[model samples]
Target: MVAVRIAKETGLAIDRVTFKSSLTLDKATLKAVPAGQCVTRVTLEATVYGDVTEEQVTELGEKVHVCCPVAAIFRHLPGCEFEPVWTLAKAE
Candidate 1:
């Protein structure tokens, strides 16, 4: 699960944000492991948008990646894994 924060520090009313996913994992390795095997992978993709510049979006995304609770949980726990891949569209 991914959560995005888009509150304006400049006192602007940027109340709208968008999240999108363009890619997902084809298969998860957890299924092959024994039922007791703790190893697992959780995959996801998301995009966020609001009344903000590209730079702001990038910063927010970076912060979200750094501060996500699920990410932190997986990092501290043993045998859990995550593989993230990103695709960028060409600018027109």
Candidate 2:
């Protein structure tokens, strides 16, 4: 939904959007409160189709991070990185 909103904001028509998520937690650090989950990162690879420009894709990338609530929540945590990658479909 976050991606859809940003894509709409950027006016980039999109096809299926898929993502993979991996979360890391440290048991010792959970007790110690060390650097937010003992260091964590969420990398989102967005595969898109349709007649979207690179500039639009870039805008979508920027907007999603800035507007995403989940991202906003994690923005303040230490060692938390949100890596977003946008991939345009290949011409066939």
Candidate 3:
């Protein structure tokens, strides 16, 4: 995924990566709450494995918002709430 690409580019030597995400939206309307908001809340969690530092993981988390086109779109939604969680682990 995006993290893998970034790690390869930055020489992070990643062995594996896992991700979990959740999207919350109004069920009844199934549409924008205030006529511009598409998603209400988005939670994305990434567990990265490599010989990387916590700072590097944090950087990856921040950079995803800038590099991922879909994430960028979600970030701009009028009333959307974005939450990104990053976890780092040693490569096995």
Candidate 4:
């Protein structure tokens, strides 16, 4: 399972937070038998009504990334492997 947390530290009355995620299963053979692997990807999005600086958003995102439980768990596991990617876009 993948988890995402979003927080709006500064914003006007239109501040909003959203999360998106998807899961997929893949089959692979390690030695001879078949093994199933579950892959989950999560994305977090936020919109602030007022003007928000890029530096502030980057700082907040870094804080959230550091404190995220899922990221901690993935880091603690020694043999687990995963692919992680992150992106940020301004609202239109």
Q: Rate the local accuracy (lDDT) of all candidates.
A: 0.46, 0.70, 0.78, 0.42
Most TM-score-accurate candidate = 3
TM-scores of the models, in the order given:
0.44, 0.69, 0.79, 0.43
Cα displacement (angstroms), candidate 3, residue 3, comes to 1.7
**lDDT of candidate 4 over 1-92, digit per residue (tens):** 11223443333122433444443333343444433223322234433332445565555556655777866654444444433343334667
lDDT tens per residue, model 3, 12-73: 77787788889888676665355445468899888888777889889887877688887877
C-alpha root-mean-square deviation, candidate 2: 2.9
Candidate 1 C-alpha RMSD relative to the actual structure: 5.6
Off by over 4 Å in 1: 1-14, 18-42, 75-92
lDDT of 3: 0.78
The residue pairs found clashing in candidate 2 are: none
lDDT agreement of model 1 with the native: 0.46
lDDT of 2: 0.70
Q: What tens-digit string does per-residue lDDT give for candidate 1 at 4-71?
A: 34345433223344443222222464467554344455444443333555555556555556777855
> lDDT order of candidates, best first?
3, 2, 1, 4
TM-score of structure candidate 1: 0.44
